[model samples]
Target chain A: MNDAFILAGIRDVARKHVGWEGPIEPDMRLVEDLSLDSIKLLTLAIEVENRFQICLDPERDHELITVRDLVAAISHQISDTQKPEEENSHRDTEDTE
Target chain B: MNIASVGSALPPHFYDQETLLAALRANWTQRHHNVDRLEALHRNVLVGGRHLALPIEEYDNLKTWGDSNDAWTRVAQDVGETAILRALEKAGLGVDDVDALIFVTVTGVATPSIDARLMNRLHLPPRVKRMPIFGLGCVAGAAGIARAADYVRAYPDQVAVLLSVELCSLTLQRQDLSIPNLIASGLFGDGAAAAVVVGAERRADGPQVIDSRSIFYPDSEEVMGWDISESGFKIVLSAGVPEVVKHYLGRDVDAFLDDHGLSRSDIRSWVSHPGGPKVLTAMEEALELPDGALDVTWNSLRSVGNLSSTSVLMVLEDTMSDHRPEPGSLGLMLAMGPGFCSELVLLRW
Candidate 1:
């Protein structure tokens, strides 16, 4: 998946689910800039997990301060989970050939 | 009427936040989707430690709500007796001096209630009037004091003792995995408190009750409370608690103060309940409080978590003992609870 695609997904969740009217940016702090409270932050976490089909560690949420940090973490989780499936797909393709 | 003394008794079984968190994680790890979410929620409450009415291992044996209520009945009497004794002793009064006994709690129920049960144990006079309040939740601490003050105001020669025993830990629903229950588990604790309110005719070395006000928000029953079931009391906490604080607290407080020819600036001491981090933050923001105004409450929350109705009294005890303000300064004691309501009590030292 593209990083821009992940960023757009995050922006959509923030805007629609979290009710953030302000512009979502990579450097914008979720708490300080976007003004997402703890509940909203939790909602964002769950919605992001469902959207990406990847599990996010809520305990490590403190490490995700900015939108860029969140996007990067989600991207990392997606890539890691997709690796095995991608390898299996390649094996199946080669076997078919 | 004056607040003669405030005394508290915490249960013997104490555990740090990490230990409690570990125990909860172990219990919920199998069923919970993400254990990390539980840990994060617990850490966010910022409670350093809490006292439990029962031993940690003993909790698993509580198979039914009846079992929990039985434990609540046994422990409430002990703590309630001790708290009342301590408060009466501090006020240089005795059981015979207490003309009225008002008990407030929301954690559990007993047929005769804890206050009536304590009458025989504490040797309180048979003639003493008993008022057992149920379902007030956290606001009972401040509201209890206000009621005690009202009692003394009516009698003018009597002493009213208010006892609040909240065993919040016993009400924990192990089967529930909702966010509210998780937060409640992390936030609430177990304790009991008693306050001595003396009539104007009596002499006491403490703050005089100036006035009090109770404001209830209409159509907000779902804001915070307990949903009772055959199993037990499930927590009905809402994330919108902070929002409610932001919306109503400042205006209510300002109007309350204005009625007594005072303003927010006139209150030198703020003795508030330690609801939680978010509620305290919202309170500070709504009231536009000065730096360190609610430091005592914050410290209490960090140390003992929230003891439901007993918490504000613990804060009051701490304030009167360790953080006593100026001799003639004005103070305000406030708390919010399940009624989606706030109670404010003004005091003069």
Candidate 2:
């Protein structure tokens, strides 16, 4: 749910799925610095989705260029999906009260 | 030398991308965790469907290299013959007219070679020059055209036919779960294509070869190729392929054009091998092509997947039949393959 957790998830995805043993800094570009091709990026997306159990909108792939961008996107995706359930819970509590 | 015609043949069996992906997932999911990776990889190649040398169910019967290769030889002869005959027919010629026969393929091997075997089937001249080129991989389409051009240039009165038969499905490594093998399983398909090239003195209504160039990058052998083992050919496709294309293709093409008093803007047609989506995108970016410049190539990739050496020839065939450019327009046929090499053939319609 947090940035650190998402960042660590991305690192694992990069290393395990993409075979990148180098350091994955926040500023490192996925294609240029990390050498992730389109296939690698897709693999990373799926692996990250499995790790975090959240669906990533491939439509937003263009906006995710760096490790920081991916971490932020995952965080944002988690928050966006959580908001609906959170709102439903609040509505249910209010009805009960 | 003029390319009088191009003929292509896909096997009788065809399957949509979804079916193919399902088959692959079923095969790989047992050993592979996250079988979704296979799904994503198969879907992202942008191939709508593909043809297999045999029916999908029959592939399971091929349990060894010998078995698959035997199928390759049999089907290759059939498909290759059809392509050659079609090409010759389109050129208004017959088997007796072919002075040179060049056979190119990386998917399988043979002792007497397909060209040699086809002599009895097609009933060609006994003395017809035969050249069986192996291991060019994807570049053999352009490279074969270049070599045929060379032959016709020397003979000046002869006709040359280049046949490329790539049954990529036969070369699949079922046991290997390597990244390259996974990608290859999704990206490549089965097909054969033949190009009829006539000499300068011959009368043919088609694109003429103006010039050709071959460029080999050092220390990049690991970029894209195969690693042959007892099982069969294991693909060695690295993620560095697009990088190689981005780094070299544009500059090499520019220089080749410069030598002939032309530029990128002068080219009206771009007949390129559809390596995959990323390779095509890298080509478009590196060449600074206008939008839709590779529309035909993309269409071919989508319809049949990448046919190895036959891909560019199929693109050329489409260009000739449907997407024909205006008279006096220029075209370039190019492809990159093993040896981490590229072959460029300049043409004029």
Candidate 3:
């Protein structure tokens, strides 16, 4: 997934839960500014996980404090998911050759 | 007159957060679709681990409310005895020097109460006036100190002991998987703390109590408290908790400080209850504290989790041991609890 896709997914979740009618920028804090509570954050995580097919690990990425950080995490998870498949495909190609 | 000493104790059984989470998930059953929600809520409480009243495996045997309460009674006395004795030792006094004994807890109930039991276990003097306070919830720590201070203010030569034993784990409802229960299971731990406040005429070289205030918000009882039933204490943790702190904490604190001819900046040390992350953040926002003003509270949360009424006292113990401010510096010890109320105690070291 690209950054825009990740950002859009987060924004959609934020819109549903926070009900804030504003620009979805990169700098907004999920906690300090928007005051998204634990439940809202979880709801957003669930939405992101469904949309991107990525499981969010709250323990590992607890420091994802900002909108920018969250985008990076989603992108990282997507890339991490694709790597093993790519390696397996490359191995299959070598074997066939 | 002064908070002469502080002490804390925990049960031998302590578990890491992940282990407890796994156990809770197992108990709640994997068939529940909302289990992920439990994981999410539990992870965000900022707790690293907690000391439990019983072994993690043994909690499965607590099948009834009576069983849980029985566990509470049995464990409370052990930790309570340890805490009170440590406090007395730090205060350079024996059980006989204590003029009054004030006991506080919300996670357990007993007719004799833990104070009466401790008097017997510790062999305190017969004339030791006993006051057993229940249902104060988290605020009882600061409130207990305030009450003890009030006692010593009247009798200027006596020593008062305020002991708070909160076995939050013992009050956990195993079958209940409400969001509040899940969050509570994550946020609260089991422990006991004791404070020894001696009269001004009786003690020196300690933090003197300048004043204290108990602020009760009218008609907000449902904001945070317990709902007792046949199954035992069910948590009523409203989402409005942070909003409550935002709305009233600043004003109450300001008024209390103003009455004492001080402001937020004049305060040097903050002994605040680590009532999970949201409440602490709300307090920081409302008070507009400098960065790290609540570092001790956050550190306590990470280390031991919220021990209910015992939390603030444990924070006080941390303050006494690690973060002692300069002599004669002003300090504020505060907490909010089940009454949807706050107790603010001003101290000077």
Candidate 4:
């Protein structure tokens, strides 16, 4: 998984949702720096999920604060789910051989 | 018609943005899963502090709509009277001088309405005309003044008072975890404002009401309003509010000014109702106003949030007290509210 791509997607969703025109550095705090309120954050979560083809745990939203944190969470979810599927397919191929 | 003087009354219970956010979180955390979202929404409104009609702790015990609105009826009287007295004092007028009373609010309902109640409480003249308006929401402040101006313009010897009292905290729905309710919780504050409009023959010293325009967007009721039910006034706010402003406000202002043989640049000052950041930004863009044209509006939002129908009047009061535009300067006061409509009043100081 490309972390940069995930970061870019998060930035795009944030920009569109909150109208954040400034730069989105990894260190920029969502609440303090960008003024991303709760509704905007929720909208961003849904947008990120749609763009990255990942299901985010709404329950864990409190932990997703910074840009890096959001991107890492999405990347971790994608890798964890995709790796299991890949391993299952490889195991099936080996059994067929 | 002249707005002789304006005054405001805010409850003593004021809290900065963080303390209010913390209180809202403490109340809603158990029922709502998104405390983070609540905090963000509250902070993003950019409201510095607000005056609550009741003490913050008492809000928890408002168990029913009856209890909340009962509080509204009681508090609405107290603040409404205070605001009216201050406005009259500033205008060098008394209750007897007021020929008409226009009370505007949307936070609660009363059978006799606050105007009649005030007339009874203050011993205003029995012949005083009463116009109590409800459900106009934020725009009622400007619209009420416009109507009062109209009243005085017709009767050149009469004086009219527009009083608005909005207890926004009393309308909070504890059970509703919707985004609009959350935004409403942060963006709207409790307060009252009154403006005295004197007829031309009285020769009062104040800005003259040049003209007014009310534009109702047909079939746009769902854009920004309330959906009342057994519980209380549930918010019907939409993201499209800014879109509506961007589309309609510019054309509305241009047509309005052109009708008066003026244009946007000719207006030297603006007394805009600060709905929120988005709406103000949209207003600035739509009207193509220069920098600092809406500073008073942003200052009001930061200080008091949106006081519903009382907001624009509060801004007008601030303008009259602090930022008095030079005499002969052109100004505009405007607000948009539940009717999905805008009220524009042109002024010359």
DockQ of each: 0.17, 0.15, 0.07, 0.07
Fnat of every candidate, listed in order? 0.07, 0.07, 0.00, 0.04
Which 10-residue window of candidate 2 chain A scores lowest in summed lDDT?
A38-47
lDDT of 4 at A7: 80
Tens-place lDDT per residue, model 4, B36-106, is: 65576678888999999999989888999999999999999999999999999999999999899999999
Between candidates 1 and 2, the one scoring higher on DockQ is 1
* Model 3 agreement with the true structure over B260-332: per-residue lDDT tens digits: 8899999998999988898999999999999999999999999989998899998888888888999999999
Residues B157-263, candidate 1, lDDT per residue (tens digit)?
A: 99999999999999999988666787889999999999999999999988999999999999889788989888899988767788989999999999999999999
Q: Candidate 4 at B335: error in angstroms?
A: 0.7
| Candidate 1 deviant stretches above 4 angstroms | A1-53, A57-78, A84-97
Name the best candidate (by TM-score): 1
* Pairwise DockQ winner, candidates 2 and 3: 2
User: Candidate 4 — which residues are off by over 4 angstroms?
Assistant: A1-97, B31-34
Candidate 4 — which pairs collide?
Answer: A37-B40, A38-B41, B328-B349
Tell me the lDDT of model 1 at B346: 99
- Candidate RMSDs in Å, in order, are 5.3, 4.2, 6.4, 9.0
In model 2, state the lDDT of residue B202.
99
TM-score of chain B of each: 0.99, 0.99, 0.98, 0.98
Q: Name the 10 consecutive residues with the lowest summed lDDT in model 1 chain B.
A: B29-38
Give the clashing residue pairs of candidate 3, or none.
B328-B349
